[model samples]
Target: MSETATVFNQQLAARSAGGSTDAPPPVRHVCVVGGGTAGWMTALMLATTAYGPRLKVTVLESPQVGIIGVGEGSTPWLRGFFDGLGIEESEWMPACNATYKSGITFEGWSTKPGFQRYFHPFASMLDNMTMHQFVDNVHARLEGADVHAHPDRFFVAAALARQGRGPRARPNFPFDIWYGYHFDATLLGQFLAAKALERGVQHLQRHVTQVQLNEQGDIAHLQLDGGEPLAADFFVDCTGFASLLIGKALQTPFVSYAENLFNDAAIAMPTPLGGPIESQTVSTALRHGWAWKIPLSNRHGNGYVYSSAHCSADEAETELRRHLGLLDADVPARHLKMRVGRMENQWSRNCVAVGLSQGFIEPLEATALLFVQRTAAALVEALEQGDLGPAAQQRFNDSMRTRFENTRDYIVAHYKTNSRTDTDYWRANAENMRLSESLQGVLMTWLSRKPLAAGLKAGRFGGGYPIVSWYALLAGMGIFPDPRELQPPTSHQARHRLDAVDDFVARSATNFPDHRELLAAIPPRVGDKTLQLYLW
Candidate 1:
């Protein structure tokens, strides 16, 4: 406490970054809490890094708290995630009961009731200039020219999904053809777990009973259900909404954006497969909420997301059944609770949270798994930089925050852009919806029928529609561009390109056999239909 000592300490702290007297902390061994898609994703990604030898990764999960097996529709970025995991698409696709998804069929969100059917097809199906022409044609239609006829007709995914077809990738179209998938979340977790285990990632099948922190508030160790202590250098909290380590142990604050996003309750169910599920996901808006029908190979994943403040769980469940025209006795249902927001800091101290622990937006656009992929990518990038210092952590956290905000904005844009004024929920949203600042700007440019740059405001975790994508949604939803004409592409010199496009569709119709056939070819695992667990 001497004056000289105090001055020396002050000078030392002032000389360091963040004005701290301590040296930058080093991250090596990472302890991942919970073992669903996110936990294993983090482990798998970290294990692949050269830093894996110096840094050990372990996941603590109780077989009791099972994974939330809901997320079915994903953006195209998932292909990159599978590729990063070195998973062969042919091998894993069938094991997970995945069906190719081109885009989503949006229904009942317009001002006019029966005329509400529209398609927000994938962005990769249009060239930059062609998108502008599409936008111009949309404007021409508003002026009574019938320039577009049906925008969805041009969307390869939309056309294919109408009759249940996948896409045929050809070199001529190149970047203009985009597709994703609808799959079972639990099976995906098992698939990833198997891959992680194969890659030498340790998995502990135990629930964390208590977190023991050092005097510095860093997690020194974790107490298992049976009183055994597990220790690691860094921690990842993927324990769903419980947020066991980050929120409970680290005391990280959650920043809820409920004012901007209203839906908070969902009733999820998997129905026996038999419908118009070709290669697309369907989201239909009901009176009180929205219902999603995601087609996996074996079954259809259906859910109704609604505002708890406006409707009861039973009411939402009933609405979902009514929309899909199903009987409750025929299918059981599971209800899920959610808060629409993100953690104030995704990575706090030495712990990072992914999946529901990091944030949960209602399944409107299905960004949950995308969150897992992006979070894992960011963590891997940070670790690959060699040290998880304060600078690195802050950089990673800020980028994730931006990504979450962008996602929130884009999802909000869907609600705000809707012209629906049917019920209290729709009317209220149409009247008082607030948009994120970035989306406000995007909407402005989008109103002009201009394609948005893919990586526009997203720092790292941004993945959704590309340029052609934004144009598709805007035009599909009846948003038109200014009268100023947009020039078409000059690159297609070969007249056969049009024929090639038709050929692509013709082949995609019969390509890859059927979903069930694909599943039959894969080796049986647990509840796979090939195991004779259920009747076809």
Candidate 2:
């Protein structure tokens, strides 16, 4: 078993022996309030045999509340979640109008004129010699070489994405390319709800009118709209921003990231695919905030996330339409107000909050679904480790806080390193914004040298993005140290490596099929059987 699992098991054994004799019994009955991605994902995760031998999972969803449904992009970790559930990509991909995502393409984030683009590919940098290649590029840059000419060319997935292609059926690639999905969020909720119900998770379509607290201040029972009061040993609050159970009832304090992340609202709309669909999420920096374009198999999910302090909703929508070249086209748009923060304690007493109820950063990197997956997995691990006592709850809270803060730092790095000075928003984010102490320190260190993997480790559950991710964002935004800080590579070796990179790019462009063609070639699954589709 992995070290993390071993440690968790050890903690569980210790807790079961003598820790907190007065603590509540091992959580067997779990009531998840609110049914969308968060609720169903939590229910289904707990319903697994790994967690469900003595556990009963139920989901209480309100018929009156509508789903926010704007989250369309996801990180590659989602693929592991599906695999754990024994769910085939063919089973959910078509059902969700899903398309493979190589990674995100960031545009116009630099101060350079015209459009400057960079790729944050999903492929694991650990397996690939990314850092070594970065070192070579740094040496080249010091020698006045045009090393910035397609920095992402070394990444196979990024190269595929640039050519409007997906992963190819090749055996001898340098590294395995990782990919996620772009799908309809509403359909995803329906798909997960179906899976959860199939796995014996009871679903109640009723509004929660009241929350009853125990003597110790933990949630005891919930009063439904027209049914008997529902009670459980533990509760999960998936009620989105309402945070009915964790926020309103538990009164968990919130820590806002607004000081670093200025965007507070988003206007989302779906537009018909005017042409061939792209194989990645495209985030274009706009005048005020930014616009995201996620291309699903059916339609393109587009949104403008902007600072309410800098621009009005109407103005943001206009800018979005203008950027999408849809100013003359009439498409319905939904305006969403977001609270850019996380709860002080995601796990408090007997209740835990997942998804938006726990917190929300702007959807800059599609982290919402990832947090839901991580939180659900963490809760299951805690439950496996005997009773959810103070020790376990504290650990869970600390781990989640680390994850949120780390993610916040990564997202902030995008705006913090941006050189755009055209608008007030850009100026504030680039020059005047206050960064988290940790981020500031990292930035300071990077000024002297490139970020090293050993130096960037967030021990255990500190929950930062991978070291390569930081490299991509920093190098893409031209945030590097003086090239003279490093020793120059031998002239012969540099030329050979540069030639090899060029050869690889040429071969990759020819080997991969067009993104649209690849999608068209996948045979449709029949009935409900799990088809053996080539996993991305």
**Residues 1-536, model 1: lDDT tens digits:** 21222333343345453542233325657878888777887788776654435557787788789877788888766765664444666788888888777778888776442336777766543333234444445544444343442456544555556655554333232333456778888888888888888877888898778899999888889988888999888888899999888888999899997886788888998778875446777888887778888878778888988998888998888888877778546788899888789898888887889899998887887788888878876776566556677898889888888778877876776677677766788777766546655666677655554435533535222233344445455555565432254244223211123344445545544433343443445332221111111100
lDDT of each: 0.68, 0.77
**How accurate locally is residue 48 in candidate 1, as Cα lDDT from 0 to 100?**
67
Q: Report the Cα RMSD per candidate.
A: 11.1, 5.9
Tell me how candidate 2 scores on lDDT.
0.77
User: What is the TM-score of each predicted model, taking all chains together?
Assistant: 0.81, 0.88
- Estimate the TM-score for candidate 2: 0.88
lDDT of 2 by residue, 364-450 (tens): 999999899889888877776575788888989999998899899889989988988899999999885587677776676566554
Candidate 2, superposed: residue stretches over 4 Å from native: 1-25, 51-53, 113-115, 124-131, 139-150, 168-175, 458-463, 480-496, 508-511, 521-536
By lDDT, who's the top model here?
2
lDDT of 1: 0.68
Runs off by more than 4 Å, candidate 1:
1-26, 52-54, 113-115, 125-129, 139-146, 170-176, 275-277, 444-465, 480-536
